[model samples]
Target chain A: SQQGEEDPQALSIQEGENATMNCSYKTSINNLQWYRQNSGRGLVHLILIRSNEREKHSGRLRVTLDTSKKSSSLLITASRAADTASYFCATAAATDSWGKLQFGAGTQVVVTP
Target chain B: EPEVTQTPSHQVTQMGQEVILRCVPISNHLYFYWYRQILGQKVEFLVSFYNNEISEKSEIFDDQFSVERPDGSNFTLKIRSTKLEDSAMYFCASKWETQYFGPGTRLLVL
Candidate 1:
Protein backbone atom coordinates (compact mmCIF):
# COMPACT_ATOMS: atom_id res chain seq x y z
CA SER A 1 0.00 0.00 0.00
CA GLN A 2 1.14 3.53 -0.68
CA GLN A 3 -0.48 4.75 2.52
CA GLY A 4 1.53 6.97 4.87
CA GLU A 5 1.86 6.20 8.54
CA GLU A 6 1.52 8.95 11.10
CA ASP A 7 3.21 9.03 14.47
CA PRO A 8 1.53 9.93 17.73
CA GLN A 9 -2.00 8.66 17.16
CA ALA A 10 -3.28 11.38 19.49
CA LEU A 11 -2.01 14.42 21.31
CA SER A 12 -3.41 16.66 24.03
CA ILE A 13 -1.77 20.04 24.48
CA GLN A 14 -2.51 23.29 26.18
CA GLU A 15 -3.34 26.39 24.18
CA GLY A 16 -0.32 28.46 23.03
CA GLU A 17 1.87 25.37 22.80
CA ASN A 18 3.30 23.78 19.71
CA ALA A 19 2.01 20.51 18.30
CA THR A 20 4.12 18.43 15.94
CA MET A 21 3.23 15.27 14.04
CA ASN A 22 5.26 13.10 11.70
CA CYS A 23 4.35 11.03 8.63
CA SER A 24 6.29 8.37 6.81
CA TYR A 25 5.47 6.78 3.46
CA LYS A 26 6.98 3.95 1.47
CA THR A 27 6.69 5.22 -2.12
CA SER A 28 8.22 7.91 -4.22
CA ILE A 29 6.10 11.04 -4.22
CA ASN A 30 5.87 14.26 -6.19
CA ASN A 31 4.45 16.24 -3.30
CA LEU A 32 2.90 15.90 0.14
CA GLN A 33 -0.02 17.83 1.56
CA TRP A 34 -1.43 18.32 5.02
CA TYR A 35 -5.14 18.62 5.74
CA ARG A 36 -7.24 19.30 8.78
CA GLN A 37 -10.62 17.69 9.41
CA ASN A 38 -12.91 18.87 12.13
CA SER A 39 -15.12 16.28 13.80
CA GLY A 40 -17.45 14.85 11.16
CA ARG A 41 -16.72 17.76 8.84
CA GLY A 42 -14.99 18.40 5.53
CA LEU A 43 -11.23 18.31 5.02
CA VAL A 44 -9.56 21.67 4.85
CA HIS A 45 -6.32 21.85 2.88
CA LEU A 46 -3.55 23.18 5.09
CA ILE A 47 -0.28 23.14 3.16
CA LEU A 48 1.67 21.35 0.45
CA ILE A 49 5.38 20.61 0.22
CA ARG A 50 6.97 19.41 -2.98
CA SER A 51 9.50 16.61 -2.78
CA ASN A 52 12.17 18.84 -4.25
CA GLU A 53 11.70 21.30 -1.42
CA ARG A 54 12.81 20.84 2.13
CA GLU A 55 10.54 23.18 4.07
CA LYS A 56 7.57 25.46 3.61
CA HIS A 57 5.46 27.60 5.86
CA SER A 58 1.99 29.09 5.79
CA GLY A 59 0.59 31.21 8.57
CA ARG A 60 1.22 29.33 11.79
CA LEU A 61 1.73 26.01 10.01
CA ARG A 62 5.16 24.70 8.98
CA VAL A 63 5.75 21.60 6.86
CA THR A 64 8.99 19.83 6.06
CA LEU A 65 9.65 17.00 3.62
CA ASP A 66 12.64 14.68 3.44
CA THR A 67 12.43 12.58 0.31
CA SER A 68 15.46 10.49 1.22
CA LYS A 69 13.69 9.34 4.34
CA LYS A 70 10.24 9.29 2.75
CA SER A 71 8.97 11.28 5.67
CA SER A 72 7.34 14.59 6.44
CA SER A 73 6.34 16.57 9.49
CA LEU A 74 3.79 19.22 10.32
CA LEU A 75 4.24 21.78 13.07
CA ILE A 76 1.57 24.12 14.33
CA THR A 77 3.17 26.83 16.38
CA ALA A 78 1.30 28.40 19.25
CA SER A 79 -1.71 26.19 18.68
CA ARG A 80 -5.11 27.50 19.63
CA ALA A 81 -8.12 25.59 20.88
CA ALA A 82 -9.70 26.21 17.51
CA ASP A 83 -6.73 24.41 15.94
CA THR A 84 -7.87 21.16 17.51
CA ALA A 85 -8.63 18.61 14.80
CA SER A 86 -7.29 15.55 13.05
CA TYR A 87 -4.19 16.27 10.95
CA PHE A 88 -3.58 14.06 7.94
CA CYS A 89 -0.70 13.81 5.50
CA ALA A 90 -1.55 12.88 1.94
CA THR A 91 0.98 12.18 -0.79
CA ALA A 92 0.78 12.56 -4.56
CA ALA A 93 2.77 9.82 -6.22
CA ALA A 94 5.69 10.73 -8.42
CA THR A 95 4.32 8.78 -11.39
CA ASP A 96 0.64 9.74 -11.22
CA SER A 97 -0.15 12.81 -13.24
CA TRP A 98 -3.70 12.90 -11.97
CA GLY A 99 -2.33 13.35 -8.44
CA LYS A 100 -4.27 10.75 -6.51
CA LEU A 101 -3.54 11.30 -2.84
CA GLN A 102 -2.73 8.40 -0.54
CA PHE A 103 -3.58 9.42 3.00
CA GLY A 104 -2.17 8.38 6.35
CA ALA A 105 -4.01 7.47 9.48
CA GLY A 106 -4.31 10.92 10.99
CA THR A 107 -3.13 12.31 14.29
CA GLN A 108 -5.98 13.57 16.43
CA VAL A 109 -5.03 16.78 18.24
CA VAL A 110 -6.82 18.38 21.16
CA VAL A 111 -5.85 21.80 22.42
CA THR A 112 -7.16 22.85 25.78
CA PRO A 113 -7.70 26.48 26.62
CA GLU B 1 -12.99 31.03 -2.96
CA PRO B 2 -14.26 28.23 -5.18
CA GLU B 3 -14.80 24.84 -3.55
CA VAL B 4 -16.33 21.51 -4.45
CA THR B 5 -19.95 20.91 -3.46
CA GLN B 6 -21.79 17.68 -2.73
CA THR B 7 -25.48 17.00 -2.37
CA PRO B 8 -27.44 14.99 0.19
CA SER B 9 -25.15 15.55 3.15
CA HIS B 10 -26.46 12.38 4.80
CA GLN B 11 -28.08 9.22 3.50
CA VAL B 12 -29.31 6.01 5.09
CA THR B 13 -29.81 3.10 2.74
CA GLN B 14 -30.73 -0.52 2.98
CA MET B 15 -28.32 -3.20 1.86
CA GLY B 16 -28.51 -4.30 -1.81
CA GLN B 17 -29.96 -0.95 -2.81
CA GLU B 18 -28.29 1.36 -5.30
CA VAL B 19 -27.27 4.86 -4.32
CA ILE B 20 -25.82 7.72 -6.34
CA LEU B 21 -23.67 10.30 -4.61
CA ARG B 22 -23.35 13.62 -6.38
CA CYS B 23 -20.65 16.29 -6.54
CA VAL B 24 -20.17 19.58 -8.37
CA PRO B 25 -16.53 20.44 -8.60
CA ILE B 26 -15.10 23.90 -8.68
CA SER B 27 -15.69 25.50 -12.04
CA ASN B 28 -12.61 25.71 -14.31
CA HIS B 29 -11.01 22.82 -12.47
CA LEU B 30 -10.53 19.80 -14.69
CA TYR B 31 -9.66 17.02 -12.27
CA PHE B 32 -12.16 15.29 -10.00
CA TYR B 33 -11.82 12.48 -7.48
CA TRP B 34 -13.79 10.39 -5.00
CA TYR B 35 -12.51 9.17 -1.63
CA ARG B 36 -14.03 7.49 1.39
CA GLN B 37 -13.18 7.13 5.06
CA ILE B 38 -14.75 4.52 7.27
CA LEU B 39 -15.42 5.44 10.86
CA GLY B 40 -12.13 5.98 12.71
CA GLN B 41 -10.08 4.97 9.66
CA LYS B 42 -7.82 6.69 7.20
CA VAL B 43 -9.22 8.10 3.98
CA GLU B 44 -9.01 5.81 0.96
CA PHE B 45 -8.90 6.88 -2.64
CA LEU B 46 -11.72 5.49 -4.74
CA VAL B 47 -11.44 6.86 -8.28
CA SER B 48 -10.17 9.79 -10.29
CA PHE B 49 -11.78 11.45 -13.31
CA TYR B 50 -10.23 13.74 -15.86
CA ASN B 51 -11.00 14.77 -19.43
CA ASN B 52 -14.46 13.23 -19.15
CA GLU B 53 -13.03 9.81 -18.41
CA ILE B 54 -11.54 7.84 -15.56
CA SER B 55 -7.89 8.71 -15.14
CA GLU B 56 -7.15 6.22 -12.40
CA LYS B 57 -8.89 4.15 -9.78
CA SER B 58 -7.79 2.20 -6.75
CA GLU B 59 -8.39 -1.51 -6.22
CA ILE B 60 -11.25 -0.64 -3.95
CA PHE B 61 -13.11 0.77 -6.96
CA ASP B 62 -14.42 -2.49 -8.26
CA ASP B 63 -17.34 -3.57 -10.46
CA GLN B 64 -19.78 -2.46 -7.80
CA PHE B 65 -18.69 1.14 -8.21
CA SER B 66 -18.96 3.53 -11.16
CA VAL B 67 -18.23 7.20 -11.71
CA GLU B 68 -19.68 9.58 -14.27
CA ARG B 69 -19.58 13.22 -15.25
CA PRO B 70 -23.05 13.32 -16.77
CA ASP B 71 -23.17 17.06 -17.32
CA GLY B 72 -20.25 19.42 -17.75
CA SER B 73 -20.50 20.36 -14.11
CA ASN B 74 -21.51 17.35 -12.05
CA PHE B 75 -19.61 14.21 -11.09
CA THR B 76 -21.42 11.23 -9.65
CA LEU B 77 -20.52 7.93 -8.00
CA LYS B 78 -23.02 5.09 -8.28
CA ILE B 79 -22.86 2.04 -6.11
CA ARG B 80 -24.58 -0.83 -7.90
CA SER B 81 -25.31 -2.70 -4.71
CA THR B 82 -24.65 -1.23 -1.33
CA LYS B 83 -23.12 -3.38 1.37
CA LEU B 84 -22.82 -2.89 5.10
CA GLU B 85 -19.13 -2.20 4.65
CA ASP B 86 -19.99 0.66 2.30
CA SER B 87 -20.92 2.83 5.22
CA ALA B 88 -18.44 5.70 5.17
CA MET B 89 -17.94 9.41 4.73
CA TYR B 90 -17.61 9.99 0.98
CA PHE B 91 -15.64 13.03 -0.07
CA CYS B 92 -15.39 14.65 -3.49
CA ALA B 93 -12.35 16.70 -4.42
CA SER B 94 -11.27 18.76 -7.43
CA LYS B 95 -8.10 20.47 -8.44
CA TRP B 96 -6.39 22.75 -10.84
CA GLU B 97 -3.18 22.70 -8.87
CA THR B 98 -4.01 21.90 -5.23
CA GLN B 99 -7.06 19.78 -4.48
CA TYR B 100 -10.02 21.23 -2.62
CA PHE B 101 -12.53 18.90 -1.03
CA GLY B 102 -16.26 19.19 -0.57
CA PRO B 103 -18.21 18.80 2.61
CA GLY B 104 -18.57 14.99 2.64
CA THR B 105 -21.75 12.94 2.38
CA ARG B 106 -22.08 10.55 5.30
CA LEU B 107 -23.49 7.22 4.15
CA LEU B 108 -24.94 4.56 6.41
CA VAL B 109 -25.89 1.22 4.92
CA LEU B 110 -28.00 -1.04 7.07
Candidate 2:
Protein backbone atom coordinates (compact mmCIF):
# COMPACT_ATOMS: atom_id res chain seq x y z
CA SER A 1 0.00 0.00 0.00
CA GLN A 2 1.15 3.57 -0.69
CA GLN A 3 2.03 5.46 2.49
CA GLY A 4 1.98 8.92 0.92
CA GLU A 5 -0.74 10.82 -0.97
CA GLU A 6 -0.10 13.95 -3.01
CA ASP A 7 -2.68 16.66 -3.54
CA PRO A 8 -3.73 18.35 -6.81
CA GLN A 9 -3.11 15.44 -9.10
CA ALA A 10 -2.40 17.95 -11.86
CA LEU A 11 -1.29 21.59 -11.95
CA SER A 12 -0.67 24.13 -14.71
CA ILE A 13 1.33 27.32 -14.34
CA GLN A 14 3.18 29.92 -16.36
CA GLU A 15 6.89 29.50 -16.91
CA GLY A 16 7.96 32.07 -14.36
CA GLU A 17 5.36 31.21 -11.75
CA ASN A 18 6.04 29.25 -8.63
CA ALA A 19 4.73 25.67 -8.46
CA THR A 20 3.78 24.13 -5.14
CA MET A 21 2.95 20.48 -4.55
CA ASN A 22 1.97 18.86 -1.28
CA CYS A 23 2.30 15.31 0.05
CA SER A 24 0.96 13.65 3.20
CA TYR A 25 2.04 10.35 4.68
CA LYS A 26 0.61 8.02 7.32
CA THR A 27 3.68 6.62 9.05
CA SER A 28 6.83 7.80 10.77
CA ILE A 29 9.65 8.08 8.28
CA ASN A 30 13.41 8.02 8.36
CA ASN A 31 13.43 10.31 5.35
CA LEU A 32 11.26 11.70 2.57
CA GLN A 33 12.56 12.19 -0.92
CA TRP A 34 11.16 13.87 -4.03
CA TYR A 35 11.79 12.84 -7.60
CA ARG A 36 10.93 14.06 -11.08
CA GLN A 37 9.97 11.98 -14.08
CA ASN A 38 9.87 13.13 -17.67
CA SER A 39 7.20 11.39 -19.70
CA GLY A 40 7.51 7.59 -19.36
CA ARG A 41 11.24 7.65 -18.67
CA GLY A 42 13.22 7.12 -15.49
CA LEU A 43 12.99 9.08 -12.30
CA VAL A 44 15.56 11.71 -11.26
CA HIS A 45 16.21 12.19 -7.60
CA LEU A 46 15.67 15.83 -6.69
CA ILE A 47 16.01 16.21 -2.94
CA LEU A 48 15.83 14.33 0.33
CA ILE A 49 14.84 15.68 3.73
CA ARG A 50 15.60 13.71 6.85
CA SER A 51 13.09 13.38 9.70
CA ASN A 52 15.10 15.71 11.92
CA GLU A 53 15.16 18.47 9.36
CA ARG A 54 12.47 21.06 8.80
CA GLU A 55 13.44 22.70 5.50
CA LYS A 56 16.06 22.47 2.82
CA HIS A 57 16.79 24.11 -0.53
CA SER A 58 18.58 23.22 -3.73
CA GLY A 59 18.85 25.68 -6.58
CA ARG A 60 15.32 26.87 -7.27
CA LEU A 61 13.69 24.05 -5.31
CA ARG A 62 12.62 24.37 -1.69
CA VAL A 63 11.17 21.56 0.40
CA THR A 64 9.56 21.64 3.83
CA LEU A 65 8.70 18.80 6.17
CA ASP A 66 6.43 19.08 9.19
CA THR A 67 6.72 15.87 11.15
CA SER A 68 4.00 16.92 13.53
CA LYS A 69 1.51 17.08 10.65
CA LYS A 70 3.06 14.26 8.70
CA SER A 71 3.07 16.40 5.56
CA SER A 72 5.66 17.74 3.15
CA SER A 73 5.64 20.29 0.36
CA LEU A 74 7.82 20.98 -2.65
CA LEU A 75 8.08 24.46 -4.09
CA ILE A 76 9.73 25.10 -7.42
CA THR A 77 10.42 28.79 -7.63
CA ALA A 78 10.51 30.53 -11.01
CA SER A 79 9.40 27.44 -12.87
CA ARG A 80 10.42 26.73 -16.43
CA ALA A 81 8.73 24.94 -19.31
CA ALA A 82 11.41 22.30 -18.93
CA ASP A 83 10.20 21.78 -15.37
CA THR A 84 7.00 20.26 -16.66
CA ALA A 85 6.89 16.67 -15.46
CA SER A 86 5.51 14.32 -12.85
CA TYR A 87 6.68 14.81 -9.26
CA PHE A 88 6.59 12.03 -6.71
CA CYS A 89 7.26 11.83 -2.98
CA ALA A 90 8.62 8.60 -1.50
CA THR A 91 8.68 7.90 2.19
CA ALA A 92 11.41 5.81 3.81
CA ALA A 93 9.64 4.43 6.85
CA ALA A 94 11.49 4.29 10.13
CA THR A 95 10.31 0.75 10.70
CA ASP A 96 11.07 -0.49 7.17
CA SER A 97 13.57 -3.32 7.58
CA TRP A 98 15.26 -2.50 4.32
CA GLY A 99 15.55 0.86 2.58
CA LYS A 100 12.20 0.29 0.89
CA LEU A 101 10.21 3.23 -0.38
CA GLN A 102 6.46 3.74 -0.43
CA PHE A 103 5.65 6.24 -3.15
CA GLY A 104 2.76 8.60 -3.47
CA ALA A 105 0.40 9.01 -6.41
CA GLY A 106 2.43 11.76 -8.11
CA THR A 107 1.58 15.33 -9.03
CA GLN A 108 1.73 16.16 -12.72
CA VAL A 109 2.99 19.72 -13.16
CA VAL A 110 2.80 21.53 -16.49
CA VAL A 111 4.77 24.74 -16.79
CA THR A 112 3.60 26.65 -19.83
CA PRO A 113 5.79 28.94 -21.86
CA GLU B 1 28.62 11.30 -12.49
CA PRO B 2 27.79 7.63 -12.94
CA GLU B 3 24.22 6.42 -13.52
CA VAL B 4 22.33 3.15 -13.84
CA THR B 5 21.89 1.68 -17.33
CA GLN B 6 19.32 -0.76 -18.76
CA THR B 7 19.46 -2.56 -22.08
CA PRO B 8 16.93 -3.49 -24.79
CA SER B 9 15.00 -0.25 -24.32
CA HIS B 10 11.88 -2.09 -25.48
CA GLN B 11 10.98 -5.76 -25.75
CA VAL B 12 8.01 -7.77 -27.01
CA THR B 13 7.32 -11.40 -26.15
CA GLN B 14 4.48 -13.88 -26.36
CA MET B 15 2.61 -15.00 -23.27
CA GLY B 16 4.20 -17.92 -21.36
CA GLN B 17 7.63 -17.07 -22.79
CA GLU B 18 10.58 -16.13 -20.63
CA VAL B 19 12.04 -12.64 -20.71
CA ILE B 20 14.98 -11.10 -18.91
CA LEU B 21 15.37 -7.36 -18.46
CA ARG B 22 18.90 -6.37 -17.64
CA CYS B 23 20.45 -3.45 -15.77
CA VAL B 24 23.88 -2.30 -14.72
CA PRO B 25 23.81 -0.24 -11.59
CA ILE B 26 26.34 2.38 -10.56
CA SER B 27 29.85 0.97 -10.17
CA ASN B 28 30.04 1.41 -6.40
CA HIS B 29 26.43 1.24 -5.27
CA LEU B 30 25.62 -1.67 -2.96
CA TYR B 31 21.81 -1.71 -3.01
CA PHE B 32 19.69 -2.56 -6.09
CA TYR B 33 15.99 -2.46 -6.86
CA TRP B 34 13.42 -3.12 -9.60
CA TYR B 35 10.31 -1.06 -10.16
CA ARG B 36 7.57 -0.92 -12.81
CA GLN B 37 4.94 1.46 -14.01
CA ILE B 38 1.94 0.75 -16.19
CA LEU B 39 0.95 3.40 -18.72
CA GLY B 40 -0.38 6.45 -16.91
CA GLN B 41 0.17 4.97 -13.44
CA LYS B 42 2.44 5.57 -10.49
CA VAL B 43 5.75 3.72 -10.40
CA GLU B 44 5.43 0.56 -8.27
CA PHE B 45 8.18 -1.20 -6.34
CA LEU B 46 8.79 -4.84 -7.29
CA VAL B 47 11.84 -5.93 -5.35
CA SER B 48 15.00 -4.79 -3.56
CA PHE B 49 18.35 -6.56 -3.51
CA TYR B 50 21.46 -6.19 -1.41
CA ASN B 51 24.53 -8.39 -0.90
CA ASN B 52 23.41 -10.39 -3.98
CA GLU B 53 20.08 -11.43 -2.46
CA ILE B 54 16.51 -10.19 -2.35
CA SER B 55 15.87 -8.16 0.77
CA GLU B 56 12.23 -7.31 0.17
CA LYS B 57 9.42 -7.60 -2.40
CA SER B 58 5.93 -6.38 -2.95
CA GLU B 59 2.80 -8.48 -3.43
CA ILE B 60 2.97 -7.66 -7.13
CA PHE B 61 6.17 -9.66 -7.19
CA ASP B 62 5.09 -13.26 -7.13
CA ASP B 63 6.29 -16.66 -8.35
CA GLN B 64 6.64 -15.34 -11.88
CA PHE B 65 9.31 -12.78 -10.95
CA SER B 66 12.91 -13.28 -9.88
CA VAL B 67 15.94 -11.00 -9.51
CA GLU B 68 19.65 -11.76 -9.53
CA ARG B 69 22.85 -9.79 -9.35
CA PRO B 70 24.85 -12.28 -11.37
CA ASP B 71 28.03 -10.19 -11.40
CA GLY B 72 29.35 -7.15 -9.59
CA SER B 73 27.55 -4.86 -12.05
CA ASN B 74 24.61 -6.57 -13.74
CA PHE B 75 21.21 -6.89 -12.09
CA THR B 76 18.50 -8.72 -13.94
CA LEU B 77 14.78 -9.41 -13.57
CA LYS B 78 13.37 -12.56 -15.12
CA ILE B 79 9.72 -13.32 -15.62
CA ARG B 80 9.50 -17.09 -15.94
CA SER B 81 6.14 -17.09 -17.75
CA THR B 82 5.03 -13.76 -19.09
CA LYS B 83 1.42 -12.63 -18.95
CA LEU B 84 -0.34 -9.99 -21.02
CA GLU B 85 -1.01 -8.10 -17.82
CA ASP B 86 2.72 -7.84 -17.22
CA SER B 87 3.22 -5.33 -20.03
CA ALA B 88 4.81 -2.24 -18.49
CA MET B 89 8.02 -0.24 -18.13
CA TYR B 90 10.54 -1.96 -15.88
CA PHE B 91 13.09 0.27 -14.18
CA CYS B 92 16.23 -0.69 -12.27
CA ALA B 93 17.62 1.45 -9.48
CA SER B 94 20.63 1.43 -7.16
CA LYS B 95 21.59 3.28 -4.01
CA TRP B 96 22.65 3.13 -0.41
CA GLU B 97 20.44 6.01 0.74
CA THR B 98 19.61 7.93 -2.46
CA GLN B 99 18.55 5.89 -5.49
CA TYR B 100 19.54 6.54 -9.08
CA PHE B 101 17.28 5.10 -11.80
CA GLY B 102 17.98 3.81 -15.25
CA PRO B 103 16.12 4.85 -18.38
CA GLY B 104 14.03 1.64 -18.04
CA THR B 105 13.07 -1.28 -20.29
CA ARG B 106 9.57 -1.39 -21.71
CA LEU B 107 8.29 -4.95 -21.81
CA LEU B 108 5.20 -5.84 -23.81
CA VAL B 109 3.79 -9.33 -23.36
CA LEU B 110 1.55 -10.12 -26.27
The alpha-carbon deviation from the true structure for residue A30 of candidate 2, after best TM-score superposition, in angstroms, is: 0.8
Provide the lDDT at A106 for model 2.
95
RMSD of 1: 0.9
Model 2 reproduces what portion of true contacts? 0.67
Q: In candidate 2 chain A, where is summed lDDT lowest over 10 consecutive residues?
A: A1-10
Give the interface RMSD values of the models in order.
0.5, 1.0
What are the per-model DockQ values?
0.94, 0.78
With candidate 1 superimposed using the best TM-score fit, by how many Å does residue B47's alpha carbon deviate from the native? 0.3
Interface RMSD of 1: 0.5
**Cα error, candidate 2, residue A20 (Å):** 0.1
lDDT of 2 by residue, A12-68 (tens): 999999999999999899999999999988889999999999999999999999999
Residue B97 in model 1: lDDT: 78
